[model samples]
Target: MKRPKPTRRKRQNLCADKGYDYPDVRQLLRDWGYTAHIKSRGEEQSERKQIPGYRARRWVVERTHSWLNRFRRLLIRWEKKVEN
Candidate 1:
């Protein structure tokens, strides 16, 4: 099967952690037309202190995972039937 073409946007953002904060990774992301939002190591804490209401992109995914974890059935996939 042929690969589907990705939809292009005027400003596409890529949220990543400090591990991806490298010149090569940044350049690759730029080449692929993504605006990288990867924070450098130890940079987040300082920014949090300076900015009153700053929140990183990854936190949203973490928060959602935390919320889902509260539901044992959903997290563990207790239901075998798809209809359930």
Candidate 2:
């Protein structure tokens, strides 16, 4: 039996909350070659809040969801055939 190879992650950044800012967690992220974006305790809110322009990225996600919702089959799969 041939085992399937694991798929590599394309994005290298690891975004997390302050809870993951521990030293061990940071070391783990470094070992995996991921750039950690974890927030530290008492750290002020990022520039995303101060600068409104930075929030434009969120629209991309919202727009994609809206576009997908336009497809009735994607919203609710009514096709009986698995390949349909």
Candidate 3:
């Protein structure tokens, strides 16, 4: 699959969990013109205690996966034919 090209008009942002909190990943994101919003391990927990109504970036992605999992067909590969 082809990757989408970054637009110069507006800046792009990449939200990821602590697992991707590496120097290489940060450099790659910078090269790709994305504003990385990756937090270090335990950073989110500390912020959550101090800030009210603070939400982690990964929460949205996890919620989306939870919603998608409700659909049995999508959770499992039931279609053998690509046209289906």
**Candidate 2, residue 58: CA error in Å?**
17
**Native-to-model Cα distance after best TM-score fit, residue 22 in candidate 2, in Å:** 0.3
Cα displacement (angstroms), candidate 1, residue 27, comes to 0.2
lDDT digits (tens) for residues 2-74 of candidate 3: 8776665555889999899999999998888888999998987887899887766898898998888878566
Query: Each prediction's TM-score against the native?
Result: 0.48, 0.41, 0.51
Q: Between 1 and 2, whose TM-score is larger?
A: 1
lDDT, each prediction: 0.80, 0.73, 0.83
Q: Of the candidates shown, which would achieve the greatest TM-score relative to the real structure?
A: 3
Candidate 2 lDDT for residue 63:
89
Error of 3 at 6 (Å): 2.0
Clashing pairs in 3: none
Write down the lDDT that model 1 would get.
0.80
